[model samples]
Target: MERVEPMPLGGDVARRADAHAAAPLLNCLIREVAQRCPGQGGRRVYRLPGGGRLLRVREGRRPADPEVYTAGAWQRVGHTDLVKLVAEELRRHTGLSNDELPAEMIDSRDAVAALLAARDRVAPPADPYLRSEQSLVTGHPYHPAPKARGGGPVASWLAYAPEAHARFPLVLLAVREDALVEEGDTAALDALGQAPPGYRLLPAHPWQLDLVGGDLAGAFADGRLLRLGTTAFDVWPTAAVRTVHAPAADPAPGADLFLKFSLDVRITNDVRRLWRHDLLKLRRTDTAAAGAIEAQDGPAAWLSDRGYRTAAFAFEELAVLVRDGLGGHVLPGATPLLAAALAEGFDGNPLDGPADPAVWWEAYLRQVVPPVLNAFARHGVVLEAHLQNSLVAVDTGGIPVQALFRDAEGVKLLPDVTRAAGWERLVYCLVVNHLTEVAAALVERHPDHDPWPAARREFARHDVPEIPRLLTSPTLPGKTNLLLRWTGADGADARYLPLPNPLSGP
Candidate 1:
């Protein structure tokens, strides 16, 4: 992963980690629980209603330098103190206590610290794409604990972590053909390695293997699963720790593939697993998404989740998804960078050096907005176009030329959800989650540039009936990640609160 500068694990490392950890928590706190209490001089001040405490911060897309009012003055709190403050406020606000989320918040900070330390010893990949994929240190900008690795010991997950520039070979297993349960096209798996006559090839994440080893011991012993050693090539983990990408295979050409696996660890709100229900519905969702993107007029593409394979004995625990890689979709001369990495600053970020902010951003809006709107309006497919799920391909001149959207598991079919619900989700994922972050990053980089006008025009061009209301709506739905976690709601069960709509602003 591209890093900010190298720092010794000691000295300012803890402070830096504190800052990294604090941004998202602060964002969630201010967005969900804290009420705006007028501007304090040039800084933003908020009143935490539950605790009756006044807090102030240097606010932007990513708020920072937090200070709480106390003793007739303001006192800055470290991450530990911030976690305690958040917990106390949530407890009072919700009338319930959550020890786990706070602990995860701390774990997330410590994980950032460990990632910073590990990154110092390693060299970043020469490939800019890999660097972009691994660039997230503060992940999920609005999430309370985006980097928490199930609170597991540093030694366990560090090596597999993408933030540490991790690359490793997949553990190859041969499942008895009769014991394997698979769907759709998974032929790509056979080429990864060879299996015996009665067995099918199944690649596993080493970290996941370690997590579920005991449960699979019986299968191994009884010959339902056979060890076939590791793949010859190393795969790089993406922002999503469980999904891995295999670059061009050594002698074989066109061997690029992305494999998604079941991770027992909880990175964000939910345990990152390839759940059976989603897996069963994958092909249908992916097919619909692919068809929609194909029908769109622009260069936007859908990275289809082609298929999955697993042992029936441990369906959810052992499932691995096959997704189309960048080789086919990306433009010939352009580089595909993770959209999240662009929002989260990376070393060679394309947004950093755009010649004209207007042209670049207009191109970006052109490539990204239409396909998403068309898919929902024309095909009843709602893509999870959040930053993490989107890839923006930029040409050599650092101009965005194409947008590739992925992860069918997160796609919601139209009739599956009511039209209102689907539009709300499309708005949240496309506008609130995706465009807002990109626009914020652009505005932060070029202070004089305002991106919303172009965004408004882009939405105006789309024929969806909801576009008109969306353009005039005074408020946009913002997912309450903090409240959702504290209330122990399912990760998929999204609850939203109103956020000021810049689209409607003068």
Candidate 2:
């Protein structure tokens, strides 16, 4: 096991937390509401459209050190003051009042503080992939409240938080055979724990169980659900928060497996529940995604959502989706790292010390871009290939060799939506959300390196009809996460605003 990186503690946690929370909030405010203004000094400045206030920050990928012009003086705003400013600005901009979002922003900052404190006490996993999966302290770089944990007491969620490097056993349960609702291949669940006669084994996330336990009392009281002991081995939580990865043979006789659970907590946009509607269509979506990736002519792979199981009585509340682990998919001798963690940065990030960044980035685009384009162009499958949903496996020399994508719930099939709509979504997920962040992070490290020309070449390599326009389009769709949350829009209902396309020029 490599030595874990030391994290900030004591007095630094609060100050770091303030910075961590402010960056994303500032990003949202600047992107959604603030109009770019002429900078006075080296710092970047923007004028708030609604409040008519001047805001300035030390600009980079994640903007920081926010200050507002007040009474002829630029006064620095801390996390709390920033939240108030955002809420006021948003309320005036949208002509809508939202008290929930501001509270969530505050909660998200508190969560970061708690995560930093907890992380200081634990050792990170030895596996680079697991470390990468658990390393998102400042999540969703553009969301208003990326780390909010349902605005609950910290103690309630801390033990299960991925950012705090938490790993715990699943609470095993048994649903009566007649009451068991399942689809696809869930044979793996039986290996986790034993079920009594006439009942099938089901694994439940402890946090989800706690949130929905009241509604499940009837099943427990009756013969519908029975309590089985917890799993013998602890599973590591991924950045998704609700999903956990059980190490190979941790409980014996099986490879590593990812288990996605019904988390009632609202992590970023919506309550992270395995809704019945999504679950019902899981097999169809998973099948399409798996088939699409399998057909692609590269090392790209899809971590198939094999199956799910839950008590029929509490379907969405107790559901757990079993996903393919990295054992078979990732090339041997290559370590798979979460793409988001690469962008966010971790202790052993290969992106940190690339000798030839252009070569490394070209290799990255080769592995990442084609599979997504092929999936959409050939198989009519739209993968949510954003940072979190993507993983890049690198060889010993830290060159990306393979790309893997996951999350069946986010996959959209063509003809179900118009070709134009699918193309738009593909552009947003593949280009705006995924590549742009990675490119910016690369540029941040290697100031002289330009990633877009290689990206343009990579896009030009593909025969997809949208490639020409994608390279020539002046603006790309940037999801309006701030406006969506403020207006109480559905999390799945994505609204986009135009963002300048670097690929469009040159």
Candidate 3:
């Protein structure tokens, strides 16, 4: 396989890490910011509007062979060069300077190198669920630095990295009941382990503990918090990284439970903490989502965020969310897989099988489309139905039978956000981010196939007012992750650029 341009880095692993990290960052640069420059030789070249330097790459879905036109010849760019080049270009483009983004880019590349090396030593989990979780090496295809791990040390995050296929037990703690803060139903937690009198059991993500342990020294010293040891069973980290699957939750089958923790690390566009504001609204939002799903017809399910619990002193750092697991909701005999993993490809992805292309695409639409529309149009609930937040279940025949959506924190209540804002967010998540990736992957494996026509038909059936405009609009809102980071905007604040709508084009 093609790796990064020759570098004095470690080995195949480091070069591979460079290639993986650089591609997504370059994708954002080329698509959202860079303008097409007339070609030279046989290479595809683009002029960076900000830096005014010609950048060239082997053009495809994921661009490679990044070179900058300098002096006389094209200088092959390494990961560090690419980061500097991106930072310079963004500075000129935005007329702003960001000291943090460049470091994040370097940190992201370094994290990938670490993950690559760790995966080489760790065996991927045999379970399809865990395998799918661990398989996202490329990560967010559009984000400039999807794999960045808060710029922390490798040893600090490696043991909990889903990409490394590493699984470990939760570091159980006893928060003095007087110090315990909670919301919603956190009853399921009590079954996992026990706590001493006047102490409530609070399970902590091992990595999060390591990251913020020093920050909580006083609580431990005052006996407000006591380490109650670790869970006897290991909960495998999912693709989301912070959330984990305890396959054995005793009476509550593994499928019926998930524990999401706050990691003091910035993942994707945000510091992935179960923020206090979001946690406070979890019940209202999740209830809206669950009620919407229950009212609809089909196998679609909302993996409700049941509740959260944490110590008052370390609310954000120690908070853990209980999410409904995927077991009871899944159809009988159907196996569920991560939607992102399917698009990105995993060992046993049904999309990779010999299923009929047309039937497969149609089945996929039937399972994924209607519920999302129904939830939005009928109930005014906006779900972050992106690939990672969605799971598709397929039968023994490899045909999708149901769609399950999770991460209530990403959901927006109807009146909570203006209808316009919510619809735009829903459109960005469902169509641009979710469906587009899956459609492209399907077309990639079957070149003659066009997934958009079916997609167009499915979307058209929805009576939502935006459907007509969406069907004919030449451009869809594309999120600007690279620029957003360079400009140092809030991660929750989405800024969009116009992208050619595939449903409108051939």
- Per-model C-alpha lDDT, please? 0.91, 0.90, 0.86
Model 1: per-residue Cα lDDT over 441-495, one tens digit each: 9888889999999999999987899988898999999999999999999977899
Sorting all predicted structures by TM-score, with the top scorer first, yields 2, 1, 3
Error of 2 at 68 (Å): 0.5
The runs of at least 3 residues in candidate 3 whose Cα sits more than 4 Å from the true structure, single-residue gaps closed, are 1-10, 38-43, 249-256
Give the deviation of candidate 1 from the true structure as CA RMSD: 2.2
RMSD of each: 2.2, 2.4, 3.6
Q: Model 2 over residues 10-38: C-alpha lDDT tens digits?
A: 77899999999999999998888899988
- What's model 2's lDDT at 250? 71
Summed over model 2, clashes come to 0
Off by more than 4 A, model 1: 1-8, 249-254
* Superposition TM-score, candidate 1 onto the true structure: 0.97
Clashes per model (N, Cα, C within 3 A)? 0, 0, 1
Candidate 2 lDDT (Cα, whole model)? 0.90
Regions more than 4 Å wrong, model 2: 1-9, 249-251
Clash tally for model 3: 1
**In model 3, what are the clashing residue pairs, if there are any?**
256-325
